[model samples]
Target: MRNVVIGFLGTQLDMGKRRRWRPTVDLCRTEGFPVDRLELIHDHKFNRLAHSVKRDIEEASPETEVLLHRMDMDDPWDLEEVYTKLFDFASDYGFDEDRERYHIHLTTGTHVGQICWFLLSESRHIPAALIQTGPPRGGDDVGTFDLIDLDLSRYDALQQRFDQQTREYGDLLKGGIKTRNVAYNRLIDRIEQVAGLSDAPILLQGESGTGKSELAQRIYELKLQRRRVKGRLVHVNCATLRGGTANATLFGQRRSFTGQAGTERAGLLREADGGVLFLDEIDALGLEEQALLLHAIEAGQYYPLGSDAEVTSRFQVIAGASGDLSAMVSEGVFRIDLLTRLNLWTFHLPALRDRPEDFEVNLRHELAQAEKTLGIRVGFNSDASEAWLRFASAPGTLWPGNFRDFSGAILRLCTLAPRGRITRAQVVDEIATLERRWRAADTDQNSQLVAKYVNGPVDPFDIPQLANVLHTCQTSATISEAGRRLFAVSREDRKSRNDADRLRKYLAKFDLSWAELNDG
Candidate 1:
């Protein structure tokens, strides 16, 4: 089997052009390289591009069997089916693994063709190269750009370097990816809609814990699916911006100016110039930075740090804020003009407490993720579910930290729990501890004492409230008649109606009755 040169061709119908690698294909032939096969991926928009590429490959190389893989990035992929089809086709054609030559040539159309190429080459431990064709209108070097031939094998020795870089990038995106109450299906719909629109500064408004970053990424991915936006998603957190450091970070400072090593660094905006630029915690950005950002978005231009030349702004800006940016504008803390510009398609993420219906779904998702990541089969029992509901439904039980808090709590419980399964009692104990921490950390200083009391060791003298609760549980003849009660009441209140309500409310919170407790 001669080397099968797999060229993943991406096209843009909106741009009115299809990316053709016939020239690159010819380059391989000129070099006497055995280009045995080709695979073309057309994401929904370009039927003409797909057919054109197929016909061109067939005519150019009679021995090279061209395979067309149809996909819509908006639709959920069946990974198993895709894998089966790909390998099956290769098998039928007797594709030799050793002879697999993958060259990712990005045709002249839209931007996302690069990512499509990345996806194909990453499927196997094979070599790949990326090249740009002429611009959408056609001509040499019109769409031409520098090429990056990725060497995956080098990544093994540079794991720490890449891990550190990726982690730093992810940290900047933390505020955006935080879990919230937005419906998953609705989010997907919004992403697809955003992809079709042109030059809109998207405003993703939500509470502190809502996942705006993930939605921003979804928007980027969906746009890339269109074949127009080609660059990778670059995230920036305005909150973490420091004085005198912001400009240098956004527009790379000259290496010679600071005498730093390595080639000139690219800012997030420049790196994602042709794709999506996610601005998280945009509310935290300084007035000057905000002005610059507005200019970049409105005029499609920016001045690099320590440079007199102006650069074209080719990226789509998606801004995220935790609170009401409009109100901030009114208060003069934020620029009204900038706010108006960014508030193009605003989406307010609801808090988790407002979406009680999503509790079960969120819990199941978190647990499954934990099992997969940690290689553990931890599970919850009926009682644990009841306990979780009690906390999830409580008046002050708002998950301020959102899904992140929930995930952390679950991970701790799974690690601390016994081998069999976690029970309601265990969950209740964890919730109590978590509640205490939240209270202590909150702005209200009065809550500190309450939080301390709940977390501290229980002593009879510490709280008279426990004595009142005991009196109600013990003196209820209805509870006694249901079953033999175990706890002895403090001699404080044997016949208080108010006491009965307290006991009843507590039991109701856990979906249990006084009779059930007495039965135990």
Candidate 2:
């Protein structure tokens, strides 16, 4: 079967000064070309311009079937969104490798589009070899092309070096955080690779106090160490930038405005001209600001509030948001284009509650941080330390604000500690205070039900099992349902699947019956 070819039409397809035999026609009409069908992806915005080129191809290449697809992209230069749309289209197209071989025409589309196609092909997402068209060396059609595969497997030496560098980057990210969780370590490893190479905008999504700012700072520090950035890191909290001041603070204004200042004030974008710019709480920023930010991020160009001249700021933006951006996009609040740019390299930092394994390691690090920052040594008394660790990591102990709360806990204890030593009294008070706060905030029926049914002073060692039981009970409609949910994964191993009986026995330890617990 003749190889099926897929390509996106760029503006140059018809707008170029060069005469007949445009790249699309040449790719199809070239002598001995093996195109069974040519799939052309075009944006509706350029419908009129694309129509002429589509007609020209049909008239010139009668042998190949030309199929046109209408794909829309808000910005041609925003490859992040462009790739996502194209990848989705390709995925849904569902190529049948058994029936026909495929080839991707790489000469068409924007430079951004071409790069995205190359990346998709490399990852096997496109499932095709590359077909690159160009002007002949001597006197041939410009669209006469050559087929090639990246064949990265052949470069053993380069691959080895890359693997080694990746390991080193991973080590650097974990140097100070002291994280022990395997999944978190892998996440940091991927982050290190992206941080070192791509200058594309990075979005760090998570809860309010889930270390997004700290990670961004570390990324900046890593970039600085590698000589990737020359200037200092500029951080802006979107929550702090409000109303009329938001635009002026981010984009800057000329010194000669109605409320003219003595000297010209550079905006945050300009301040981070050659380094990293981190925007925290990006969900709080205005929609207008997000639109301007899209231009700045995509093209590195933005006009100041009071200036007619456009300014350029080349900086890597690391944005942090606590909630879902897609929901904001649907709500018509956050610009989808801005979110698209930032979504290129998104890394969601798991909240402390999610990664319980890292709690002990992070807790120790927090205390160490207190010691280092305050120039004071504070050690936990044996009983006090045990009690605090047990309560902190146990199930139903909701750490509402994550590490931020944990940090405050350390500070409060450190401040109240007598003679630089934490005692039992302080630990109990801290636990009681935190529990009260979570109880007041947590209105979830499952949460309230768990607290009501579960035994007091949740043991840290039994946290996992207790949590599982509580969750099972909360979700199960009947005692049998809860037992089935718990045993579904392990039923094969158990000789007797006494789901309801098992659930009843377990609830007995908490001084409660299934009928009694179910009512709560």
Best by lDDT: 2
Residue by residue across 91-207, what tens digits does model 1's lDDT show?
Answer: 454434475645655553234434444555566433466654443245543233334457655667577786664443333333223334447445534544565556587888877
Candidate 2, residue 324: Cα displacement in angstroms equals 0.6
Query: Candidate 2 residues 1-520, lDDT tens each?
Result: 6679999875675555675546776787767765778888888887876777778777877667778899988887997898899889878988888888888888888889889988988888888889987765567544556887765676788789878777666666665766778778888988987888888888999998888988888888888877888888999999888888888899988887656556466899999999989999999988888888888987889999889899999998999999889877866779888888889999988878778787778778888989887789998999998898888888877687998999999988987889999999999999888877765555344344556666575454454565568767755667888888888988879899999998788768766686775554
Question: Residue 65 of candidate 1: its Cα lDDT?
Answer: 74
Segments of candidate 2 deviating more than 4 angstroms: 1-168, 440-520
TM-score of 2: 0.55
lDDT of each: 0.63, 0.81
Q: Superposing every Cα of model 2 onto the true structure, what RMSD results?
A: 14.8
Candidate 2 displacement at residue 456 in angstroms: 37
